[model samples]
Target: MEYADSKCNAYDTYASEAKLYPCLPPVVVPSAPELIRVEGSAQSYRLQKINEIQKEIATERDKHANLSKKYHRAVRIVAGVDNALVVSSMVLDATGIGVLSTIIAVAIATEGAAFG
Candidate 1:
């Protein structure tokens, strides 16, 4: 009888504990995914602006490089033409024959025209 009473008492205790600690609805805390999504949106917006600024900087650099190259090329061309003219004049002074001078002058004129 005592054994049966003990078994019954154990079952009753378990049942009372289950009833006392009934399952409750979970607290409605914001999910980690929701918080992460909000942060991600803000970060993406900042990154996009940074990327746009970087692109603009790259374009400006390219334009500057192109202009520099063009300027250098123009300087080189002018220097070469000036040197050629000086050499031609020296040669003409050295060779004082009339026919040869005429031919050389004509050639120089044509070269000048082509280069200029």
Candidate 2:
């Protein structure tokens, strides 16, 4: 029988034995303590990364909360101003002063200028 050696060349083994058993090269394995140390280091690294990510998430949540508050406040202010405008417009229309027509003409002119 013939088998490939470490150099990958096939050689006959039948002269010494009728049967040949395939064997693999010996492998060097780490000791238990070495393996534990490596695993511990990896676990610590992962935990550290997790903590950093959690902090970043917290920061972003705070930013989002602040932005949401500001947005709501602006919406409320705009709504109040719109209500005031409606009341004023009604008062002007009821007074028979021709101010509403003037305001409408000005608004139309401003709109045309802005859009064009």
Best by lDDT: 2
User: TM-score per candidate, in order?
Assistant: 0.43, 0.51
Task: Let me know the TM-score candidate 2 reaches against the reference structure.
Answer: 0.51
Cα lDDT tens digits for candidate 2, 1-116:
34454343234455564324434578899867544345888989999999999999999999999999999999999999999999999987787557777798899999999999
Q: Using TM-score as the measure, which candidate wins?
A: 2
lDDT of 1 by residue, 1-116 (tens): 23454433323345434343234557899756545345887999999999999999999999999999999999999999999999998888777677788999999999999999
Q: Model 2: how far is 32 from its true place, Å?
A: 22
Q: What TM value does model 1 have?
A: 0.43
**Which ten residues in a row are the worst by lDDT in model 2?**
1-10
The lDDT of each candidate is: 0.79, 0.80
Worst 10 residues of 1 by lDDT: 1-10
**How much is 25 displaced in model 1, in angstroms?**
56
What shift in Å separates residue 70 of candidate 1 from its native position after superposition? 1.4
